[model samples]
Target: MITSPIWLPATLMAGATQAWRTAVQRRVGKTLSINAAGLVRYLYGIPFALILLGGYQLLFPAPFPVLGRLFLPFCLAGGLAQIIATNLLIMAFGHRNFVVGTAYSKTEAVQGAILSFLLMGERLSTLTCAGIGCGVAGVMLLSTGGKRMGPMDFLRALGQPAAITGIASGFFFALTAIGIRRATQEVGGGDPIHAALIVLSVTVLLQTLLQGGYLALREPGEMRKVFTSWRVSGQVGFLSAMGSACWFTGFATAPVALVRIVGQIEVAFTMAFGHFYLGERMARSEAMGLMLVACGVVLALLGAL
Candidate 1:
């Protein structure tokens, strides 16, 4: 069995790298269509993912794990779910400012917790559930931009285009995590990292083919822009590969809910990137919301212990 401690560092790495990659992907979205922007990561990331898998094999040689019958279905489902989640997230970005857009999607932790429980029979401690609640409340608070609104107004706010797309994105992302974790388990191996990398490699390759083919048929012209914007697109791809590797590792080693709870740190990173890197101004409420998210993460960690 994989040691539990490995998930923490892997999740931290995943959060930081994912924040950076999403910021870069948002930049690419400015020049390309939503699907085209979504395609950039997978298209450029496949090579780096392969290299990581190859390098790991060379450093610590092992026979490739035999795939189970369910592996392809899980990988394909995970890959497709991620594609839709990514596009919806990009669409959310269009509906609101970057930071708020991301905050809206931070709901995935709670959603993943629920889905994991219902689908995988994973249970959470009371403290972890509270942490997930805190995180969700913080995200909702951020969505309001610190305005004082009644229940009705808040309900309306949740119905806004950004909220709808963001929540949908979270749901699909939860599905992706579940699918990925299940896929890795199907490998029947003791080396969690090896299984994670193999899943990562296959998932990314499938994503590239699925998204690339859609773009090729529907938006052929954008394909040129995707390649020509190589400088930025390449950075996105590399970070995406690295981030995904870490995320897959976390999934392989820990409960999906726990990994996702810790991964909420991405919201903190996203806010920092928004303020400093993108020149987006943060309101007082946004800062408060971030603190709540941090508290939630702390609670979840303590509960894990």
Candidate 2:
């Protein structure tokens, strides 16, 4: 069994930084196209990711791990999935407020659990399953816009554009998580942190190439805007790198399902940022939903014990 104290703090940091990065991405989307906005994180984050990997190497003085044949494939798959997932997420944001859009995507936790089990043969404890259940329920409630609704009405709500895009985002994000974990596992020797950082750097670089190349061919004008809007895009890049480093650390150190379950705390951080930073009003039902997500986090952590 994989166990590490680093996973908890790393997941927490990932959640916090991701929330901030996503919110900033939403802002960047206002001026840029969906694909352009999505590119901001990867294209701008390359430098930060490389700097982080270099710093870690200098500090630890570990030999680089040998890359297995699967490493490049995993990075490509994970990077591409993340690019699609992020674009879908940004699209979802257009259909709803940041908090609700993100809440819907929190379904990634449950989806990650299922994908991890089927693809990687990872299993969750009953308590962890229960926690994932609670988180999904809370996310469902949040999708209702805090209004009381019948079962059928709630079901219909799930069919909304925002819900569809958000759920699709969740599915791809789950794939991304599994890919990252598997890629990290393919690394031979070296510190797990070093392995994770290497995977992160490679994944980010690949994503930059793929997404940047697409923008260059399809929308050459947006490429200029991407560089011109560096003021805000730069922040998104830095936060994305920081958040991804932590997420890769968590994935390297624990089961992807567990890491993602704890990472559901990002919803709470998203809600806080939406309300305070973005001046968005919170509904009572949203608060209730957040409470359920928090309880789920606690239960998941307990199950990890």
Candidate 3:
């Protein structure tokens, strides 16, 4: 079956964000005012989301449901959870390491798979279960390092305020996936893609508002960042909205089994970008982990088996 052109765009978007920030750093080298690029990245994400919502509405018109308002609770909870998880991730990422965040986040696939089965009656094959196991093994292998950390050391990392927070946030993200799927069922009937878009729109909008509130308390006067830095911010918003839209659109068009299988290419995309853009050298263990993630994704997407 055809998988959507899902992972490639997402990889590009991820790379673009990194490249944009790196460019900003070079231009402002040693001037040291604000992390102009980073701020712009978050700020412009708002409008990107709005434009995405509008486009979705135009492309797929379904009435705002009057009868299915009950699902709003699920949507809201999921949204709140995503917001919390994301902010926690940002906190850790801001200080500790992006690789840590990325590696740890692989856990979400298992969480998502389990939740999908529980909440949506989407059955998991034995092979898929094995795929999930391999994914976990790969993540663990990727995360481990005798030089930097061992299993206990890794557990200690999780104990970090940010890491624990990430766990909590991941729970929310997982719940959001399931809850959104449920909400999608209510709003989208059986249309998976339609349901995914509706859920994403609702969740992203709510989360964006929450992000605004955080800015109010944290920065208080950061609105200028979005305005003055629209070039950088706009680029950010454009790429983010585009990637998300593609994921949702692809989800709507294909079987989720295939969609998620192709989605695993994101791991490869991350590795490739890191190699070329960030000058990141891959460790032997890292390569093994990446291979595992790739294998697991392929197995998860197995059409014949």
Candidate 4:
């Protein structure tokens, strides 16, 4: 089995790559319909995922595992959930500021822990729980960009369209994480990385077919837009494939909750992207929040030790 130290790098890579993917997807969303933008990642990414699996097979040949019946269903569930989550996130982007919109979805770490325990029977330690709490609090603080949010303000924010969609996005994302983990387990092989890549390939294939079919049938014009905007969409697709490869590898190596908690660093990366790339300023509250998130990360690592 892979150790925590080995999985940590994969988790971090997943988070960092995903942050950039989200930014690219958000930009694509402005031009295409929400669903179409979400579809871009799956459609364009299918080729890259295939290439990854092919390259891996060539470099280190191994017999592929025969998947059980449950594998397809789990992969399908994860793919659909991710598609829904992505679309909902894009919808939230329409309703809130970018950083705040992304922050709302960071609720996934907590929800993922609960779902992992219930659905997969993975248990987390008390220290891990504390880390999740700290990380989530830090994310919330950053969400406000240093604005002092009182109880009433917080309540009101929750009632907004963006917050509602954001929370829903998190829920589906939790499902996606669990479903993918389950799928990878079902694929069952000695090589964790190889199993992960195979699962990723299958999931990407399923998503591409599902999303592409829907777009072709209902929104043919949007399909044209997706192809026409390949330059940008290509970046979203490649990044999505790379990030998900790292994520699946992490899941194959570690407990789902631990991976998700560590994955919260994506919020910090996103915050930095907002400040540096988008010319947004981080307020004092956001800085505090980032610190809290850093503390959570340290504690999480300690707990693993």
TM-score of each: 0.98, 0.99, 0.72, 0.96
Q: Let me know the TM-score candidate 4 reaches against the reference structure.
A: 0.96
Residue clash pairs of candidate 4: none
The whole-model lDDT of each prediction reads: 0.92, 0.92, 0.54, 0.87
Lowest lDDT sum, 10 consecutive residues, model 3, at 25-34
By TM-score, the better pick of 1 and 3 is 1
Best-first order by TM-score = 2, 1, 4, 3
TM-score of predicted structure 1: 0.98
Error of 1 at 236 (Å): 0.5
Tens digits of per-residue lDDT for model 2, 1-305: 46578989999999999999998888999999998999999988999999999999898886788999999999899999999999999999999999989988889999999999999999988998999999888888887777899999888988999999999999999999999998998898847788889999999999989999999999999999999999999999999999999999999999999999999999989988998888888899998998899989999999989
Candidate 3 residue 58 Cα shift, in angstroms, is 5.3
Candidate 3 Cα deviation (angstroms), residue 71: 4.2
Which parts of model 1 have CA positions greater than 4 angstroms off?
1-3
**Model 4: per-residue lDDT, tens digit, 92-178?**
888876777888888898999899888878887789889999998887777675789998897787888988999899899999988
For residues 38-132, could you state the per-residue lDDT of candidate 1 as single tens digits?
99999999999999999999999988788999999999999999999999999999999998888888899999999999999988888988899
Q: What are the per-model C-alpha RMSD values against the true structure?
A: 1.2, 0.8, 5.3, 1.4
Better of 1 and 4 by TM-score: 1
Residues 143-256, model 3: lDDT tens digits: 452135667887776676655654554455566555554555566444444455566666566655666666656765564554665554566556555555554444444433
Candidate 1 C-alpha error for residue 271, in Å? 0.3
Model 4, residue 39: distance off in Å is 0.7
